[model samples]
Target: MQLPESQVAVLEAANADEATPVDALAAATDLPPETVTGAAFELEEQELVAVTERVDETISLTNEGRTYVEDGLPEVRLYEAALEASADADPAQMGQVIGTSGLEGDEVDIALSNYARKGYGSIDSGELTADPDADPAADPEATALESLVDEGTLEGSEDVLEQLERRGLAEVTESTVREVELTEQGVTELMAGVETAETVGQVTPELLTSGEWDEVEFAEYNVEADAETVEGGRVHVLREMSERVKDVLVGMGFEEMDGPHVDADFWINDCLFMPQDHPARTHWDRFALEQPTHIDDLPEDLVDAVERAHREGVGEDGEGYHSPWDEEFARALALRGHTTSLSTRYLSGEEIGEIEPPARFFSVEKAYRNDTLDATHLLEFYQIEGWVMAEDLSVRDLMGTFEEFYAQFGIEDIRFKPHYNPYTEPSFELFGTHPTTGELIEIGNSGIFREEMLEPLGVDCDVMAWGLALERLAMLTTGAEDIRDLHGTLADLEFLRNAEVTY
Candidate 1:
């Protein structure tokens, strides 16, 4: 049968009586390893040869290991220095001799321990004395390291390799090596003589026009062969979902709002009725800025109102926390923990001119938190914050808005648990049933702005607002179990390439 030149060469080079490693065959045939591997796979498919793969663990020296070899092992240097010292030499500290031998810090301890362990010397009465007959050639570790540097690889006792590994002198890695053998059919075929003519895998226009295709052999095409996957450039899954969220909010008659990621604590906490002594305001939860300690140009009247609300409370039946409110603390700058700061800015008329009742505003922007990185929590993430300032909005309005908002992303089963927030009265924790796991996952925290929270911002109307986690929303729609896979450094590229865009 006609075969490609590469395949024919591989088959002829294989020994009929025994298997040959792909590397050995490549060397003997003077062909590239990649070419030999590809031909071996093709020949195996035709039942002319067999391919076997074995994983090999190899030990090699690291840069530090090579340096130790060049400078002589720490123990060896210590031994030689102890041997060369005068018999009347002052009693020497083992550490000092190690130091004199060019060993420093941990190296000194390492050399002393190894020197004693090898029975090459004794450090008795703070005096170091080397064994006169302790031959350097008796050191196996030193010999092993030098051999590894020269040979580039070594196969030996795993215990020896592990000991070297623990010292940070070498590392062990696994590699798969392919071995090929001529099968009975391959031997029979080779004995019958296989053709080495070039086989065209693809028909060319020139060949078709010249009619040379009829005179040449064509390679057999295997329809079942796997091909490389092609991934075209596409929008990041998170960006696509963010745009979709904006589109849905806009469709619901909500105008988009914008705010600074770095802003004064007055707007982030004070305007939201969160006291300066609150735990969430602590250094553990919030990222305080070093520069620009205080925000400038804040409205004096609004600042005083917020301060009074915190110190003395406002309106009848409004008993404040009675905590002394420091305006300086309120003016201290920090990274905003939530986009609700944006809603606070807009509702207080500090951002836009005036906020009339029955107006809707939303912001999908990043917020920072001093949080530990995990599968679900990120140090920084996007928040979907929205607020409706109406004269008589109720809890039902908040629930209905969440239902409609989640429905836009194909989520229908949303349950709310009554929870408490410093700024929201009768607050709720939003939960959605995970599409893949089927377990309910808390996705957001929200509630109607309490009278205390709203009054400090000069808003008399009831404000129904919610701050939802955009990453959690994307996870449910995209079926990603780890929120990190949506946008974090650990994001899966394959998931992004195949993520469904419908939701």
Candidate 2:
């Protein structure tokens, strides 16, 4: 029975013999376009008026198109030039004709090619000639262009529109326009007249202070209407996964190891028995630092031992690599390629207290590699590294550890294949079948630390170590098909918001 002033005004203007566009209605009512739009929508919702929308495609000239209209289309110019020439004029090369037409680059080829296709001209051996009946003044395209310039739109076949679009002569765009008209019910309601009341959407301080709030009626709200989303605070999913991994490792009696992301290659590679000339130690695989190019804190004694291991084999019956060893390369600063570097640091006893026999150490930390990004691999990612130091560890112990480790995450089907690593002997690569792809994806690398690798670190016991992918684990556990979907810019916000963290 009661309507706002804006709604009543819009309804009155729309009560016409024919539907009127929103803009026209606004003009007739002397109301702002935006105000008229809102009022029209409200009236429609009340079934007092009907609103219909139409989508129109309009063509307009771009900067280059305007220039063509001022001069002439490339094909048209070429055709005119050919027509003005002598009937028996020397056959003009397509290029020369286009050049005479003032068209160059892609426009030259476009003009010559389309001239023949449009039946306006013919091209012979590198020559161009106009059709005897060709006339630029009567060209349909020229007429279409003139019409577009005057009316700002073209009513033509799809082929005509596509031709102009392909030649970069015009741009086509779509616009949606709405029209409003009163319904039969609206006419009846208007005849009875509309009455408005002082209704409050919110109680203002002035109204409360003046004690006038109780005298006015408040508009009823549609509680079921959609509201803005409010996201509550929670730890990031990656951080939560990190915490869960830490809990699993700790539960398995593994003491967590922590170290710097940037470190000397001495501990990361040299102490791990990696040859100085190894490809992975090169710039392509390692991120070498510019500032502070070399770390000076490496222990002198440890450096000497690692240097000897590279120059000379570890134990009896060994032939070390004959390649030259450079101490500077060993001391070069770089981002750690794997958290196994931390394992090397801890086993060396420089940090995380002294490494004793029967030691179980693991590091769930970030590592940087000079890697190309893809659906699965990231340049920087979390690596799950763990090492167990015992009197005499075997490959069986390594397999068992992985079994129990993945078991915590409900991954039971794990298989290992013999593989090779620079630091670990009897090496094996861990694999798990992808749930979606059904392909066996490599999870990580593991093997027993060779004497050459352990001796330099001052660890006399047999050490079994493994480096696994944390992202792959997250993907498997959380049903993420793409590893990138778990983190980084490409991650889906909707998926992150609704993704339930698996225990």
Candidate 3:
């Protein structure tokens, strides 16, 4: 019997008495593992060899995991600290115990989350208690990490490994391992004497010139063989969504706006009629700057106009906040919490030198805020700010515009609820039904710009504007349950690679 060189080599290397891994066969035949695997598959097709596949997983500790193995698990350290404070007898202050534990920032949260889950103790009302019976030294996860460090791998403890991976303390990789062994036909053929035959793997110019292409035996290809996955560079879902949003707005007759991310409070909140004492303007909510605290270049005339509007009023019937308004406070610089600052700059004719009626402007920009992180909220996010200046506008116009815009992305079930904003009168919040959860989520805020907000900006016509959450829009479009899955440190790479942004 005759066979291709690669196939004969693989078949001779494979043992009939025992199954050999593809790596071992490659070593014996002095061939590449991929080539040996392909040859094995081809021989299996001819019923001369049997090929079996199994998934092999490798586990390793991440840098964080290694640190824990050396120093100690965060939860274990917290437990030891609590015990030292006599927390096992009575609940001790969480702050004191945590301070003694030497855990800071994200490590504190990690310790708290795992401490209660491992039958360690209970945390209640700013207090922590340790379970005297619990043994921190015997924690399965810590044990697994130590074993991996010493032995380079683990035999069992799948559940513990999974928890470690979830906590970002470990990594697991899986690969398909193929094993080959000779069948009855292969052994019989080997005993009958097998010979190597000339086989062509590809069509060559010489073969064609010699007129031997028709008579040459071509090697069969195994289409079902396992191959390596190669990930190529592609546009991120957030960037793709941003471009699509710009295109949609431009198509709707809106010109893009641009401005500074860190600006004076004069344009960010003062021009919007927000009170200086408003809670949202406090350091707890806004990101205040340290160096170069105040802006050096605010238009003098515009500053006077805005200050008067804040203290006195906009018109005969307009009334002010009846509070102190200071130029020094307005000059303080900070990161803009929303993109409305751009609208103020454009409306005051300071950006492009004056404006006409019936003009449309929009901006898709980043905004910073000191917010508690959650599934829907992040520290910084993209805000889609827009405004329309015309003779007359109403709530009906704003709702219709939203309906038209959302329809482009296949979202039609939009709900509106009355809300409050300092700059817009008759303000309302926009809500959309979540595609996956079947629950309503707040998507944006919109209303007609009030007289107090517009008169100071030197705009005589009515303007309707809105600040929409770009991440919420993406959630409704992509059916993502968490905003972190789209972009963040904990973002899901597999989900991003496969997530499709329709429309």
Using lDDT, give the best candidate's number.
Answer: 3
lDDT of each: 0.83, 0.80, 0.90
Candidate 2 residue runs with Cα over 4 Å from true position: 4-187, 226-237, 478-500
Per-residue lDDT tens digits of candidate 2, residues 220-262? 4544322345887766667778888889999999998889999
What order do you get sorting by lDDT, best first? Answer: 3, 1, 2
Question: What's the distance in Å from true for residue 254, model 2?
Answer: 2.9
Candidate that beats the other on lDDT, 1 or 3, i.e. the better one: 3
Candidate 1, TM-score vs. the true structure? 0.63
Determine which window of 10 residues in candidate 2 has minimal summed lDDT: 220-229
lDDT (10s digit) by residue, model 1, range 140-190: 788778779888765356666756775668877777788899999999999
User: Clashing residue pairs in candidate 1, if any?
Assistant: none
Write one digit per residue (lDDT tens) for candidate 3, span 1-503: 99999999999999999999999998999998888989999999889999999999888888999999998998899999999999999999999999999998867766886788798899887799999999987898888888898999863577787667766678988888899999999999999999999999999999999999999899888888666679987899888888889999999999999999999999899999998999899998999889889999999999999888888888898789999898999999999999999999999999998999999999999999987565678889999999999987999999999999999999999999999999999899999999988989999999999999898889999999999999999999988877877888767677689887776
